[model samples]
Target: MATVAATSYVMYVILRRDLQTKLGWPLGAVCTQAAHAASASMWIFRNDPNTEAYTSNLDSMHKVTLGVDSEEEIKKVADKLTARNVDHKVWIEDGFPVCIALKPYPKEEVKNALKGLKLF
Candidate 1:
């Protein structure tokens, strides 16, 4: 019999590109939003096994930041993640959605869910 090693966990942060092009938000503000989303998700899933593995390996912790076009697009992604029962946090500012952070998950487990997004 043979055994396979589990895939390493990854955290995915999706930000709204419009924050810059449409809203004229500075790079620092956009970065802050991403940080807020990532921190919130990590705190919410702190006890999750995948999160535990990801955090314990700080030097190799994997995080991907992708970009969506607008708030509607981000909401759609959040909805899909919710339907798949993926743990995540959606950060809103001034009553509008800014970005989202998905809890650490095996790369293969959440890869398809992020299709169509581009690197931030």
Candidate 2:
């Protein structure tokens, strides 16, 4: 029998819930916001050790998809993450911030700032 070291890294992909609930965006369109942010975050931090580790195991990548009620709420979370020095990307379309994606990191390192969000 063989054992592998435990990996606790994850990428947080947050979507603006209002886009679908209040603004009437299609599910596909809103999900695309999350996809764009996640992709950008991964690409931008491709060389980071945590990202490398997270991607190294393609069969076991971990991601948390969360939702914020409005633009203000989402931006607040982004600001909080920024204050904490967490790396993330705020996806923008037509100059409006649509979603946020954080670079892959140890779950314990980034979960606090995101504790309030609900799964999307």
Which candidate comes out best when scored by lDDT?
1
Q: Residues 26-92, candidate 2: write the lDDT tens digits.
A: 9999988899999999999999877887887788888889988888888898899899999999999
lDDT of model 1, residue 26? 98
**TM-score for each model:** 0.92, 0.92
The per-prediction CA RMSD against the true structure, in angstroms, equals: 2.4, 2.7
What are the lDDT figures for the candidates, one per model?
0.89, 0.88
lDDT, residue 15, model 2: 90
Task: List candidate 1 stretches off by more than 4 Å.
Answer: 1-7
lDDT of 1 at 31: 96
